[model samples]
Target: MALAAAAFTAGCGGGAPRLASYVSPQFGYTIPHPAAWHRVETDGGRRVWFLPQAPPAAQPPEQTAVDFLVVMTRDDPGPLPEIDVRRLAMSLLPMHGVSGFQRAPRGNEEIAWYRFELTGATGGREWASVGLLVTGPKRLHYVVCAGALERWRTAQKVCDEVLRGFVPGDLSR
Candidate 1:
């Protein structure tokens, strides 16, 4: 894949970040992510990592993660003979409370992916998100990477890199 590395200017005035690869044997997938983001554990065996737009204050709050990437796996219900890209997009629309929902193209042949944008209802926040749906040998995989829409112009490159570098592993093991 032609995943060009475009220069990214941090919205928080931080320097350009170095990327690192995260490999999960259990989930059977590999993805490159920003080295600065902290990996946090969420429910349902899901892996979530996030980085705040700005540096933390002297006294950080309960949580600081803002922009994030999430990867999870589920059992594949076989091929989708009834679903096309548009129909799949419609079925996976962002949940309520996220307005201005729209889908774009994302991912590769092994992985059916889609891009979406939305405005948060509370603060009118803008977000850019990408979803990757992988039909693994024994299971299905989904990955999402999202960031502030204001930073998307520069962040899109990194997001693309993550998707392109993502390698699907054997979940049936």
Candidate 2:
């Protein structure tokens, strides 16, 4: 975990362009990622995915599982609507080897989520990923899950930990 935190500090605090404070944020929250993961800053924003060298077994050995990609905008008004999200999701299916997608909701949020079932090479054959659209006080959360199929479903508790931790940074801070 130490390595993971170090990676985040180095990756997010280093000489990247200073991002202007988000304006009128709603769910603008930040979670101090645990020490075992790495912060992957994408064109969208900062992301945290598993360390490349971490063994696959390090994740829960289940049929399907949850991974995270939380995004906070410079301004958090709210999440995009379902129609837009669904369209956006469909756009990504082709990129991640997804054959197709079915739109759905994630709790109270209007999200167009889908799952991908593929083969896992390490004797696990069920692979799935879920796309979620979350609106908060200062950020829009997107959780794209990747894991073994059935196992991911059962790992809801694990994923909830990620969801429940969302907290808006002080607008004053």
Please estimate how well model 1 matches the true structure, expressed as its whole-model Cα lDDT: 0.51
Local accuracy of candidate 2 as per-residue lDDT tens digits, 85-147: 455544532233444344434333432233323223223344454444444334444444343
lDDT, candidate 1, at 144: 60
- Provide TM-scores for the models: 0.62, 0.42
lDDT tens digits, residue span 73-138, model 1: 666653222244335433432423333323324434443443343322112444566556555335
Candidate 1, superposed: residue stretches over 4 Å from native: 1-15, 53-66, 79-124
Task: Report how far off residue 19 is in candidate 2 (Å).
Answer: 27
Question: Per-model C-alpha lDDT, please?
Answer: 0.51, 0.37
Q: Which candidate's lDDT is highest? A: 1
The alpha-carbon deviation from the true structure for residue 51 of candidate 2, after best TM-score superposition, in angstroms, is 4.4
